[model samples]
Target: MPLVALVVAALAIGFEQLIQWKYGPMGIIAFIALTIGLKAKNTAISGLGAIILVMLLAQSN
Candidate 1:
């Protein structure tokens, strides 16, 4: 679980960089791949939840 979380975190950071580079769709693709590859429901859910939170926070700001 911890390893999965760490990998997800790394991927998330990479996705964020991809988004910053204007490859937003690729970021989503990467996210989906990460989620599916991990094969952990909690990891996938937390990853999506974090993405949502970041999007919401960015929109609000």
Candidate 2:
């Protein structure tokens, strides 16, 4: 159980860093928009999240 917990925690940290690197700075904005869209079931907000995420990715490359 302890070993599993350690692995899970490490995986979580790795995923967090991966997302940060993948999203760059606007990751926070996209995350917020995604959360709002999910909670409110709003397509417009979801679209905004997609747009923001795409824009950030495009800028990176």
Candidate 3:
């Protein structure tokens, strides 16, 4: 249903905003890259984004 899809999208946007607030712009960039890469079916882009996310996680602790 369109309403369900809209709600999911709104939730996703809010979640992304939370991530950005907590982790900063790089987090947003990394997530965007990961999402886009997966959608586009590009392994290299996805791998790079995964690597960045891993690094960010490591740095957090």
Candidate 4:
């Protein structure tokens, strides 16, 4: 259930980026939701990693 939400949130972020939408802090919230849903230390860490990767790419412009 939570993993599903996480994926949805991630996809949403991706779409927003595709359309050049600017959302401040929403990505952090999504990452938090994903971490909680993951319920594993390693998963949470990886989720953060993925979020950072996305954020970096988003800010590259």
TM-score of 2: 0.57
RMSD of 4: 9.0
**Top TM-score model:** 3
lDDT, candidate 4, 1-61, per-residue tens? 9999999999967865653444445555555555565666567666775676477567867
Off by over 4 Å in 4: 21-61
lDDT of 1 by residue, 1-61 (tens): 9999999999978867765465355455555555564676567665764575466447657
Quote the positional error of residue 12 for candidate 4 in Å.
Answer: 0.2
Looking at model 1, how many pairs of residues clash? 0
How would you encode candidate 2's per-residue C-alpha lDDT over 18-41 as one tens digit per residue? 767777657766866876897899
Q: Each prediction's Cα lDDT score?
A: 0.63, 0.79, 0.89, 0.63
Count of clashing residue pairs in every prediction? 0, 0, 0, 0
Question: How many Å off is the CA of 53 in candidate 3?
Answer: 1.1
Q: Which stretches of candidate 1 lie over 4 Å from their true place?
A: 23-61
Relative to the unseen true structure, what is the C-alpha lDDT of residue 46 in candidate 4, on a scale of 0 to 100?
61
Which one is best on lDDT?
3
Give the per-residue lDDT digits (tens) of candidate 3, residues 1-61: 9999999999989989987997799988988888889999999888888888888889999
lDDT of 2: 0.79
Better of 1 and 3 by lDDT: 3
